[model samples]
Target: MVLTLTTFLLTLLSIPLLQKLYTLFYNAFLHPLRTFPGPPYVWTDWYKCYNDVYLNRNWTDVLKELHEKYGDVVRVGANELHFSNPSVYNDLYSPTHRWDKDGALYRVFNQDESSFGYLTYREAKARKDILAPLFSHRATCEMQGIVKKHLDRMCEALGKREESSDMLFALRSFSLDCITTYCFAKDVHASSAEDFKHPLVEAMDAAVPAIRVLQYFNPWRKLVFGLPPWLAKLTDPNAGARVELQDMLLEQVKEFVEDPKRMEQTSNPTIYHRLLDPSNGPVPSLKSLHDEAMSLFFGGAESSGNVSMLGTWYILQNPSIESRLREELREAWPDLEDMPRLEDLEKLPYLTAVIKESLRLSPSVPVPLPRVVPPQGATLSNHPIPGGTIVGMSLRFVHQSEEIFPDPQTFNPDRWLGPDASSLNKWLVAFSKGPTNCIGQNLAMCELYMAFAALFRRFELVLDGTRSEDLTYSEGFLPFFNPRHMRAFCRPVEA
Candidate 1:
């Protein structure tokens, strides 16, 4: 009996060793990517799992060094190649390309069939087709009032704060309010909270660290996310928050269903209106509706808020930039008392340049967006990549390519100021490019422009003991700022 128990324990230990041996042998000698140039451990999944999930190393830095050493194309995983060339953006992401989202990697995020998680071409196309109108240029324009209200509240709240405030939390709270307003059809006043620590905002922030854990070992995602309330509260750190957020959103769906005419009656009808409209065909399932709303809330809040907070820090660091931006705003909107229109802000070249540079320097989604190579295979940077392999480019690495943008690490708005700015747009993958790119981009842009215009025009921002490296990110799926050090102090600009 003792021998039998000892044998079982030995077998358990040997299984993983045997599996690792098989993986290493297969990836190094037998895999189709065997010829790809990369670090020895790139052939092993353990390398990726350790760095991305365990250590949370900056892939942007990791991939950049690998590419510089091995040339533009470097193998990052057993079947993955990281491309640094800007010219291949279209080839990889354009609709003509057969490349699709890496199902295995993205599934862990559980986007719930939202646009980001759509694995199949047909499903994504159908969903995008349905929701496209809401994010159209016209729709974004129409939503300016909602965005402006929150921006106003953020500025007001900042003015009220006596001490330095964590801009990351402040901006994230504001963005959550904006997105929740759009999603639920009414503002929850999250930004107006005296301390700017809304429950949903707190929940979303709490969920980020857990994402890395689940993303690496995602077979447990269903079990954990599907946990009963009581069990989830005990086992999952974010489960309570997640439940609360979902319940809030689900209630909005209930509100829409009970009063169909509320879509017309409400000043700002929820996202559910268009989705649930009889003219739009079948209403989405409760889970899909909940999932879609939750996805938007997370995406919208994180992406735009990161841009706003980080951009604010960069602007504050440069007095000349602050002066020039304010001068541009004043020129564009001569009467400070009169609210500036979104169209007017969009036309300001210097302000536009500042926003563009900020995004380039610190894109919210800075990680490698992995897309699977088609079965037919393809060439990237003149190298023939085998089919069924994973290929991607880290936006952080791509945006920082010294070849594409001279002194790429430096934040210079002038790079986006001239006729050259048009060329720069091709490489600006912050919103990504092509059909699979961010759907909320137009709204995000509008928010950025308005927020920058209002904040810079109205207040003078100073970094309250925060260094550039304080905001220097360690990459997760999105850039992660050390929240403790992301503080900024604001003073209202004297008349």
Candidate 2:
């Protein structure tokens, strides 16, 4: 009886072991990507899990090293390949490709019905069309007042700081406030929080790092997101904000779905007007409404805030750069009381160059936006990849390319000033390229432009012992900068 029991246990375990072995064998020898080269265990998805989950190293940084060792293309997962060549970016992510986004990375967000979370080209395109009217350039131009109001409130807080204020948190607060008001007619009022330590902003900062955990072990995402507010607060008090926001969004979605006409009661023309309009098409499910709300908030706030923060830091560090920028701003608006319009700001060549450089240098959404090759298969870097292969190229590969942006590390706005600058515009993939690119970029651009104009023009900034490494971040879906953020003393100027 003892021998039989032992034998049963062995059989049960060996079956899976044998299955794993066969998978490894097939991936190593018979898989479509078999010819691709990477380190051992690359045949298993766990190779990424080990690097991203176990070792907790930056996956993009690891890919950079792998590319250096294995040449331009490296097989990073069983059916996944990553390219380090800048030229391959356009070829793989062409406007016409209409490739599906890889689900492994996107589904972790837990908003699959929303535009950013949609995997198929058709689904995403449909949502994008419905929402395009609200995010059009003209819409953004008209809503400049809302952007400026939040910017003014943020700067007012900075001006009142006793010693120093964190630009990252402050900028993120401004963004969160702007997005909530602009999109939902909900004023989260994150900007009013003392020292910019609002619970939602803190929760968001914490959440960015946690995304690494969700990426490799997605099942845990449901568990993590499913926690009750009290339990979440017990886990981490800041997490309470995340849970609270989820509940609020759920309630708001239900309200709008039940009475679409009630949108007229909102403080502004909220996204509900577009999303719930019958003429646009059928209304989405309740869950989709909530998902779209979260998607728009995150999409609007995070990168814009981070990029503007980057611009502020870079400008403060270089006195000459700041001087040149201030000289231009002063000449453009000699009286501090008379601020220029968004249209006027857009026409400032130096300011435009500075904004472009800021977008170029900031590790805006640093990770690769993964997309699946179509079922018919596709060519990347002139190599034929299988239909189901996962392919991506990090923006770092393109933005920091020395061949394209010389002295890429330096914060020189002059790069965007040259006669050849127009030719380089194709490589500026900050908003990304193609149909699935960021839909709310118009609003984000307006925010970025207004942030720079207001801050540099309204006050003189002095860094408070923030070193270069303080700005450095590890790779998550977003770059995770923590333990230290850029702090500055904002002294209001009267000219």
Candidate 3:
């Protein structure tokens, strides 16, 4: 009886000591991110990160708040750090010396082994080497006629829509049609009077929201993909949607392979032709080709579409800026019937400023792309961040910095005009910097300039019921301004 009583006494005495041990373990070994100063719960739980991202909440705003409390650089997670100082751009994203693109998040986004967007850095470099010539100025100049045909179709569709119809929906369909035509050598005609009924379009729309969820709560991708098909669907809605999309894409590719003649007939000497021809070098396997086609199709459609839509929305909201932009277009081209050449568009100062301002205000790629620290560790703002750390610079934070851009919230295109505009232009890292930056940036710019100049010159846009500042943004793999929530009233301009 005496021995049992002694054992009970020892057990009771050890509870506080065990609690202290647990805390020590968390601080020293188990918690690799403990040194970062973020929200109290962020270190202990990842759900905190998801909650902020999933709701379309600006985590950059949270980072700014932390920076206010912790200074220019702060540890925001156990193994994550954020640097708001613009100087960090040189260290983080500069071409001469920069981190590689093997981050866990990037790997998760790669849909297949053969997918161009999913390839490793070395493989990507190789792919870029092969593909670079296709996107060159010479190539774009050759393809201008093909692009213009689609833009003409888009303008006709816009003309038929009720004056106040959602331009966002119109732009989405236009971009999808343009991209799919470029990829498949055929028109999906998603922007036409007949609504889009294509299986691919339906499957892609369903997949986007699911992909966003996956991105926010990154799971063990291999384990997730390894599960039984039914079990995987039950656990991950994105997996099901992805499967459906992949099947449709594969079928489309099979059709192309079966009828090489069809591809030849429809081909306009595009990137698709280059990718399919062995003479062009390293033609991907059928599966890889499908993955790449889908990647290019979706990336081109979504990113460019969102930017064009937002640029339109921003111009509509700021009338003075819009008027100035219209004046510039008028002065440069003067004839709406004859489309401005690429060289002509380049010389329009106010048009370029308006585009710059739009990109600054509503960046389609708003989030900071995460980069893994190198083996030797890295320095940001003179602070030594340990190796294996996940570091990023938020576009939202950098573009909106009061130091870099005074009156940052206002849509002021004038900031990009005049002599001092050169200084301000240096900080506009919308497409990011370095070799890993967007490959389709030039194409995107050309499309935007054409679409904006065409639409604004033909129609006058007015906000129907939505206020510019109050417009909602849909959060997913990429954030797009919610068009369903925005109602714009348009009226034809007198020629």
Q: Candidate 3: list runs displaced more than 4 Å.
A: 1-36, 45-50, 53-56, 110-116, 193-207, 220-248, 252-263, 276-281
**Model 1: per-residue Cα lDDT over 78-195, one tens digit each:** 8888887877776778767646788766787777577777776666667777878888888888888898888889989988888887788788888887887875765777777756
Q: Candidate 2: lDDT over CA atoms?
A: 0.89
In model 2, the Cα lDDT at residue 339 comes to 80
Q: Which candidate is the best by TM-score?
A: 2
Question: In candidate 2, what are the lDDT values of residues 41-92, reduced to their tens digit?
Answer: 8987788778877888888888889999998899999989999999999977
After superposition, the stretches of candidate 1 with alpha carbons farther than 4 Å from their true spots are 1-23, 236-239, 254-262
lDDT for residue 333 in candidate 1, whole number 0-100: 75
Could you tell me every candidate's TM-score relative to the true structure? 0.92, 0.97, 0.83
- Clash pairs detected, candidate 2: none
Backbone clashes in candidate 3 total 1
Point out the worst 10-residue segment of candidate 2 by lDDT: 474-483
Model 2 CA deviation exceeding 4 Å by range? 1-10
Worst 10 residues of 3 by lDDT: 194-203
lDDT of 3 by residue, 195-223 (tens): 33234444455555554556545665556
Decreasing TM-score order of the candidates? 2, 1, 3
